[model samples]
Target: MESQKGKWWKKAVVYQVYPASFKDSNGDGTGDIPGITSKLDYLHSLGIDVLWICPMYESPQIDLGYDISNFEDIHRPYGTLQDMQDLIDGCHERSMRIIIDLVINHTSELHQWFQESKASKDNDKRDWYIWRQAKYDDQGIRKPPNNWRSIFGGSAWTWDEATEEYYLHLFTPKQPDLNWENEAARRAIYASSMEFWLKRGVDGFRIDAVNMYSKPPSHPDAPITNPSMEFQWAETLYCNGPRMHEFLSEMNEVMSSYGEIMTVGELPHTPDRSEVLSYVSAAKKQMNMVFQFDVVCIGYGKDPKFDVVPHDWRLSELKKAVENTQGLIMGTDAWTTSFLENHDQGRSISRFASDKPENRVQAGKMLALMNATLSGTLFVYQGQEIGMVNMPQSWGIEEYKDIESKNFYEEVVKTSKGDSKALEKAKRGLQYLARDHARVPMCWDSSPQGGFSTSTDTWMRVHDLYDQINVADQEKDQSSVLSFWKTALKLRKEWASLLIYGDFELFDLEDEHCFVYAKRSDCNVALVVLNFTKKERDWKAPKEFNGKSFTLLTSTYSGDGKPGELRPYEGRLYVQV
Candidate 1:
């Protein structure tokens, strides 16, 4: 066992794999654990130290795998327990760690626990999930238990006629929020589900919607935000509620007994810096890292109500967010998980780059450079290295699998009396701007189905650019985006003292199109510069440092000159002499 002494996550790079779309070994048209096991060599070659596999627990496929039916068992579609063990062994053999998704915040209604809970009022498991009597007003009109609305665009309270009560579901009705206020419920969940993996030697857990574990004691109706909507649920009071830290600390203590395990919380709506720090601080005794959503807000403008359209994020704003989080963690015991794209986000290529093919590759490389150099643990979503773009515009509504996309399309396009063409155009914009764009299948080869499966059909449509953009092709090309990523990961690991745990300082340059930052460790100094716009731009090093010797580590442009000029979307990294 590794000693629990210092921050192990500081130099780690976690790769998130959406197993359902990773690969198919039995040609079942669905990615299974066996498929993931077969590809362990590929992930190992990519320099991945940790693999964060999304939920493969038993589910009915609602909300994909988020609606977990059995926390302790693997979903049949994914494979059996032996398959999971084989994957763990495979990863461990390569010195890689595995972090499974823990979705204890909710469970599928089909789960035995939930089934028993909703059976009767006096049932032993009746209080396992949130349930309350409907409210009655002076006029004798019945109302939902709370004004909270579901994240999937409906009332959070679903009427359960069998129990004569309303149950709470933050997301789809099939997934009812577990009653964390009940100690027995919490213990049962952690002991049964969490311990099952820990005892099996799984490295850690990436808790899903972790902050939503606790809710307000009094089920008050949420205030109205949209009058036209039938019900409105304000999430402020419920999300990140009080007692969250206490619950997390207890959970952490249980995990601590196992070994030097990693814990990452997926916290949403972390209000400001202080709240963010508290969740990740060493004193919190909760988690090693927390993935905050602040960086995802980059695409949105200053006005909160402004419509979301695909646009370029200013280099300064990106620098500020990175600096803010880095400053909070630096000199402290806490750490962060930095990423440009994940399963819940659109591919960074489509979100941050121009639609042109050439420009997308350049932008992808630059973004990879910027993200990999940040002072924190890095995460690379599947296909990010190959610069996968959004699904093509030709896809129709029927072809979409994401529930959120379908709901939004119906609300924004169909309700607005838009035609099919208008809806398709709106969907393209949404895909380019929304989170679903990143959930497409991993592009491994140019073969049919992108080499993900040999089946006649896939769970989700593979990106159309799979032919030109894939791991197999890029692995052979010296200048491919995939190669650049491999190099960047090697650089990070090789220069851990300077790149991983070094001090970060943002450089102030007159050009808004360029991003400049310096990493310093003792006497060693490295500067990273990125050109965000088209056309070349020349940047001058500090006047006093003009004579300093420099070594070019990597550059997107081929030729070199003093204070080099960057080509469109080009980026460079230099080590000071």
Candidate 2:
């Protein structure tokens, strides 16, 4: 493992905030930077080391803030550049680092660079983006240059009448992919975007869809994976492509210029273990860590995430994913990121465990223990600490605001052709997999609109159970989910040696509904035992662990250091005494 002598990030807890849903200080029914600044105390109280704000750049709102129109400016609705500076200063004053999303994989079609590239055949920025001539079919009809499919749905190629060319867009048409092959484009992004933020005192960046930056040189048509598919496969061609490491290394040179900064890339496809290690290896000096999708893909059905599907996961699947990831980087200089949910995925309590009223707290604590204690940088998304559940199933298709979710719903309904079961499946998929499930406003209190905003017309509807799950209720109770998170974070920082730099091993992989693991460092050992189910299960201390005297570090139950039968959904941490 990389030396943990001065790397604060090795033991840091990062809190991810979807700026649009965090808070709104102006009562404009939309969250803003000032609103986030106002909540600094609340965040610091939770003992987080860094705050990871989602994209706030200028955009057309096609994919929330993911589609950047202006790299250096802030989105109008999010507030002015001054507001961002204030937010940064506020965080620094509180000794909390702030990292914003760096979404350079693609830019909105409305972006000036893209507009100029599509304006004419020989514009100055013509090569800035990937554009190609359309091929004519036997019937004299125009077809895309290649058979690449968009991640959102349909063809990845979009035709431009003015230029008589098809531009590449791996996501929605508005998000046209950038050509990283152009050295000028890469340098321009570094000068105009990344350096601008680093100069503003922002600690680091969470690169969005980082693996899609490089595309193949040949630009050949993707192979047909399924005979009856509407579009061909493209992820294999573009993701982790030939020149990805080269581009990242060039970018890393700039990051290294800064004294102390963190960078974590969000890699979509499951990359080979050695390939992943190269990205974050201390010798490579590329990225500090990466967020791979293997663990999160357990609940994804037979297909990719764009296909609407309900939760279909086994506890063993999660264990395998976690184990494989841990095994790859156990004694290596490379590092990994651990997170159960993000802006693209649903809540963990709802997706991984039973979120009924009686089991919410226990389930939330159990999931927290599972991720927070592992050897990685832990990321806690907004509302995750408070045990938030998925949105009500009564929400209809119209209630959904996410473009990807809505597009999936239309695709399923159209293909189903009035099949009742397919329609029901789509509804369940939305409930379990929709990005909107994590986009709901953070419930700060039981006030109108859950204290997210004074306006009743918030951007997204507040969770219906806000009254019982709000921060106000949790703050008063010592056994609340929020309290457990605070305690967990406190213990993690206090025992950094055992949790951060220790050796990891699964305690009992054979346990049906319980996940047990141990962290050993030198002569000290820390055991983490968790029950993923709602019903109480009999668990005996393993033979090797039974002989040693132990001290309880933390638990979901109300007991002290006493060892006995674990309750339902209980999680206990024990340290050798």
Candidate 3:
């Protein structure tokens, strides 16, 4: 008997599609809702149960679609509201759920609320966004009210001469932070924006920058690490403030009325597991789950992600992070979102696999197997199915389109005055943290524009290795990475009772290069093992199972059934017979 555990979303798998990079239907060199509609069958075939489409709301394109200008309408480039409805209908037709990105943490400066708020200090909407008076030093140099750094770069505050006050923009200056402190603003987001989509049949929302919605009562300066550098910290004050729970509870009250919805928040630099549990526990009445970056960000060096050091991570450390994160809410009502690559990060195969051609496929399959067997809703980003790698080293900074990536490079140059060493370091940072690595257009086939678009110029260049890694080639090969993902998802669904609800236990097998674990329940026991390095390793059956025979359910290396030795980059799921 499998442990009695059930949740609609817990049994479903989600696939994230970066709208601008997914598919281009009209030769505009940009992806739109219609483009997505054209690919519904393709998505359905992948066994994906939920489609998490990134923001398509009307925007100024300042920070890609994250800067929403109109919460109720589709961006012109993405198509009309009718197209969105049609996409929703199409998804529903194929028994797939649609969840849009809810980017309420901030809105484009072009949004009506910000426009009126900036029109005059006395305007009724002035408090809709965080506004503070400028502080003048003894020398009469006007500075921001507090020292807070923008995540993109530079000061978090931007001077607005029209109002003679500065406004907070934690991201790009064009994306102003909303004042969640105001109850009315919260109601507007909840009633007018969120309700519009929920009523339109969107199954749920993936709340963007959910923690940044709350702000501290006092505006305080972050401790300055280096006077020359821009304000280094603002997230500490704004994320998960004292009133955050109150606001979330209020929103949850409203969301409960919507009926059977799944919500996940984007949480970065989270404090600890307890805080996360508070937001996701069934009793919390907040979101259903949250996306945390503790495991993925582990490779950052001295400069927290901007460092120029070559990437390095040990398998033991990765395993420890996973175990810790799993320990936080495992077997509890709270849940976590499991993902390896998303729009903001580099491709996983490139970041984790050996450079040799043979290892890429095995490594990709290994990652899929490990993530799929984990006790959470799995999220697969586009192109990950084909084992996509990072853009070639030849890509210059000029070719990148990600606002954050470009801003980081510019900040380094401005601080270092175009010094050759500084420029090289900046390049290294871009190569590692650039969002464009995952935003590159999907490679459907080995045609011009990789069959992503008919236009000669795409928004971003396609990956150079598309010829070998395109979906067309992979779909034809039963042993390809794409096929492995299909198998993985199907197997996860088939073993939902064991894989989804079974208690996870780490194996005592001793090998630095191997990650070993098991999921156990009354009726079944499944072993998940992976070789994280480029050298072969031994997978010694545990002492209790030494004399028993295990059947191979799936293997990246097509290992011999006895499994005394595992191949490089090998991964396997086995069931005791």
Candidate 4:
């Protein structure tokens, strides 16, 4: 077995907190750092070792906190610097580590650096961000530098009248991509932004879009994927560019200077395991692990970013995604991450499991079981433990607050020319795939405010199902998803050697209804069986373990149902006896 000795993170389970939606402290309708500090005990109770808080840096909120304006300080709505320190202290006091999000790939246009960079052609900070001359047509009409499309849609190069140049923005025009090639800019990002937080006692960071740091050597028109759309998805042209590795390694050096810090990169829409390992392998010294997009992007239709016609991800494909990812860094010094939901994607309960009233609880527990058994470090997004689902039907397109969702919907509107049916279809697409589904306020109870804030309303609307699905309500029922999560985590901690670093052996790969696997440590083996479908499934153990006796460690159901039968969305964990 791989010796993951003394590595706290190898055995640690992470609970991600989306600050604005976690809990509101001062009743200002926004969850803040103080609010996170207030819940330290609750996180400890959930048995998580790390609390990974999303971006809380100063910003215009154009793309939420991802477009950081002042990384050195905290955002006003989030809290002051002292409050952030107190939060770090509180988590440490509870024996839990704290890791804040790092989002330096881009900066808010309102940022001091960007403001100066765009002020004139001769500004010292002009080269800190990407800037290019505008193209001209035969008629002498101005055009963007290339046909590159922003991840948020529209032209990647926004014409900047102030500087008489076009600036690159992989996202919104308000978020200008940083020129990592600039030595001074890289230095400032490390010393002023990264070290400032590390010196203040943050354990590490969940690096935001680390793979997007380097841009293509030259921007050229990409082949049209959507003929009707002018700008095309130029991800292949820019993602994992030539300098991507060099940049991440440089960033890793800064992180390593702070000692055994934990870092997990966000590698969106990349499923190449070999390429991912190059970033996480200890020899490479880039990251501890990375969040792979293969599993979560399974159901995406045409465009992986915004799929208008989403598919219901199948069990067989999902099983392969998990197994393939686990094999990425198995014996190597690198590791992968196990997660189904995050601030970027919709909830696992809605997408991976059934959210129907009769099945939600069981499905939630089953997913927990599946994640806890994976070889990588486990991460649970906020509201996932309690099975919070997608936004309800009553929510119109106007209710969606995510910039990406709104922009994508607007694109659809423009293409359909205000057709009612097309508009509704677009809204439904967003409902299934929007980030707001995961960004909704955490439901603490059945209160009108969903127990998130003292105010009557929140920054974003709380999921209306909060009354039916909440922490307080689930806490009362021992069979609840929350209780099962605690149980699963406790068991995982107890059997870390077998569950975390054991050899992963998958079974029944072609059995579309069931995902079966075993974690083996020498002669000791732990088996996991999950029924992905709603109907009951008759499962047969692999022949290699046919005669072995096993003890049930934890399960989604109250009763041990028939030995060979698994009820809809049921999960079972067992250790060889």
Candidate 5:
């Protein structure tokens, strides 16, 4: 029997599947729920305990599935409610939990609520979303109520002539921010929409853009910085507002009544550590964990061009980030959702490792080792296990579907006098950091269409190297990256007490290119050593560590022994005697 005190997320490894590119069962040229259901066996084989499906909600697909049109229904292209229910049932049958994306902060303008709200000023649902009359100066020229800029490059407010008021949108103009200040709206969203999924037996949710749920009552405009573009408000004033904890506590109270549900919040601009800790604290009635972005900003520096290269981040910095979290928040019931790559970021293989096949394998193994050994719930994006890298420049900007990339090209490149240079710079910027890097289809086999779709033309182009870096090809080779990932995942499962729940200790290995750490429980200890560079590095074991006998749990390197030499990009995990 599972422990009653045990939370499912405590030991879970979640696999994030972006549905549109996962697999296509009906040859529709687009992936659907049935396609995902057909691949449950593959996910199970991957040793994943939880599956986090990105938004498949009803939408216009403007920002892909993020711009939700309906809270309770599946997108028509994906499938019906029955299909969603079937997928949930199937996952439960396989002993895997399912977590759907909850995007309550904003809804598509096409949503019934928005439509009704915009129809008339006296509509019952008018206050359900943020709406305000345009501000006019003495000159009588109307402007947005506030000077807030949308995340997608425009004013945050959009005017509706019928209602004669402007509504707020933090992101794309089509997605209007909900007014959580209204009690009726909050209660209805929580009870009617979210509860609908809990009733359907979904394990929980990975709330999207969770911090933007509320805004300050002051409605103060932001200070201007750039003359050419509208100023971005200091997000802290509105985001993670005064009543955030209260609202979350209510949400948590409702969710906690259910059995062992997990809630992970995506906080865009997190305040101080203490403020963040309060939301995740076990004492607080909010969420199980929160995804932190400190690690994601490692490559981003003051100088744009200087930050573009894949170089080694100081292990000391990594150690400090981990230590800071553990010291301030780890033991206090607030946990973290640890990851290297998600749909929003570039692939770890491309971001952190060399692009060469040999180096890619080692880098993949090392990165996995680092993440799995951290004191948080682990998350692996699709194709990460096979060390999938970013797309090459073979496809032009027209082939890309990411809205952010398109906006950058059009707004920054097209408008610039140095059009050719600007376009090249924009392409380079996208080549490394665009969100589309992870949206590429999962490479299942070496066949045409990367075995994702049976149709001649897919919704998106498959990475050309799929033939050399697919699951079918890697499964047969023991030395393959996929096999290495399987071994590492199995080891993590087997040694959960030490690997998953243990305290982390960063070893002072004193090697610039090497990352070494240890996980310790009361009775056992495990050491993880990784060489992030292409040069061989020799590391000395600590003087107190006298045990020469150690079992190699997993390694990117070929051989093992005393004074072991780690090849370029190699990693190893050892169970100490």
Candidate 6:
């Protein structure tokens, strides 16, 4: 039995706002912190229980907001610290909790700590970041400490002339990895980065790349997997280091010091189920829940994170991923995040189901039902509620502003030596699974700018289909995707005892076209069936559920619901009668 823990977050659904793309308050074209405040009523109507704003901290915006220059200060374009406070207060006024993004795994190279660390060999903060001396070959050629490729591509180390040593950067050279091994440095980071907001009335945090905190002490070269390239990918080489749990536990203790708090750690290249459970287990108190990547990563190829090559995903693969997660804490003291889209992933409608004009609405609602009925906290990305799809293929690579996608594209081009076939395949793969899909500007109206900004220029391009998919149009249609999402969320809350805390059991585990599951509580059993493809699928209750008749609670398709048949991309939630 999944523990019936009564945390407010467990009964809540989160709305993630990528501030720069959500909505623009001023005419500056870039979405600001105040922009988020201006739309509180809209979000409140969607029945979202929590608001999770991505990083908008003081930064140069190199990797958007992931590279923070100042932990506590707000970015100039984003707005003043007062704007953040207003957003926080606005959420509370509307009976919703707000959480800000926390990017502690790394910081901008221009950060004061990094500046000082590179100033001199004797600088007090020299050890605050991971730095290694150059290794000289027989011919006196300098080389990086290891052959570990940067997550985005190339060597992970960047040479620093001032320090005469190479600094480790898992991502872009500008974002240096913080050395968590420095106990004093870790304590100082916790106090400066998190305490400032917790002091103000901010509810909690959505920790970015939380699992990448620890680094291997030895920094050895990984086995060469990509022979075509000089460097290789080694996520196993860096994740879950010797001191990861200790660091998280200490961070958890500090979060607890503040009143009630919710923290979610993102494990990009997650380890095994038990390792993931250890991070969120109630006994450890590391986090409220963790976001697992398996469900989103089924199509990921050999070199998981860096490789965008797509694979044909089957219904069984989806079932396995969902069951693996549901089984992780079935009778234990752990919880996991339930979501289908986020800033780092593409839209769900484009991935799991057809995004064609004719089927988009049904596909969107079907995905929403899957997200809401899952046995953990629900997290709905900004445009996900309205069924936003991927960017058009007509858009060139230059239009993709996501650093990871652009980097991967460029790397493939260089590695494949500009082979036409390889480039075509790479582009197709990226179009299907790039991060930019989730970061695109929100579609709010039929206006040319999608009502996101007053200016013609946006930091990221707005979706072209905004004319037909904007919230302004959807809000008025009773059968729109937005309306269905509202109903789904409301029902999730109304059936919390069965949907949130209930035990999950997979039905017809080998089904190829549909996803079926049962959520059972002491007094109720709710069945959720989702058709993942365009063809209709049929399902019948197994022996255990034979005596029970199910009544349609809600459905993605309109009209009377049939007990055993599911239309193309149809979804129906039923309660045992």
> What TM-score number comes out for model 3?
0.96
What is candidate 6's TM-score against the reference? 0.97
Worst 10 residues of 6 by lDDT: 302-311
Clashing pairs in 5: none
lDDT score at residue 417, model 4, on the 0-100 scale: 93
Model 3, runs deviating above 4 Å: 1-4, 225-230, 302-304, 508-511, 559-562
TM-score of 2: 0.97
Residues forming the 10-long window of minimal summed lDDT in candidate 4: 304-313
lDDT of 6: 0.87
lDDT of 1 by residue, 98-184 (tens): 999988989999999999999889988888999999998899998787778787777888888776789999998889999998999
Compared with the true structure, what per-residue lDDT tens digits does model 6 show for residues 166-264? 999998999999999998889889988899889988889998888888888889898988787778887887877778889998998888888779888
Task: Name the better of 1 and 4 by TM-score.
Answer: 4
The residue-by-residue lDDT of candidate 2 on 398-484, one tens digit each, is: 878999888888888788886888878777877888899899999999988999999999999988998888888899889999999
| TM-score preference between candidates 3 and 4, better one | 4
**All candidates' TM-scores?**
0.94, 0.97, 0.96, 0.97, 0.94, 0.97
Instruction: Give lDDT per model, in order.
Output: 0.80, 0.85, 0.83, 0.86, 0.80, 0.87
- The residue pairs in collision within model 1 are 147-221, 149-233
- For residue 571, model 6's alpha carbon misses the true position, in angstroms, by 0.6
Tens digits of per-residue lDDT for model 3, 89-124: 999999999998989888999999999999999998
Candidate 2: regions farther than 4 A off: 304-311, 560-564
Q: How accurate is candidate 3 locally (lDDT)?
A: 0.83
Candidate 6: regions farther than 4 A off: 1-4, 304-311
For model 2, the local distance difference test gives 0.85
TM-score of candidate 5 relative to the true fold? 0.94
Q: Kindly list the per-residue Cα lDDT of model 4 for residues 59-78, writing each as its tens digit.
A: 88988888888888888999
Model 5 bad stretches (over 4 Å): 1-5, 137-139, 223-228, 301-319, 325-330, 508-511, 543-550, 561-564
Give the Å error, residue 533, model 1: 1.7
In model 1, what is the error at residue 476, expressed in angstroms? 0.6
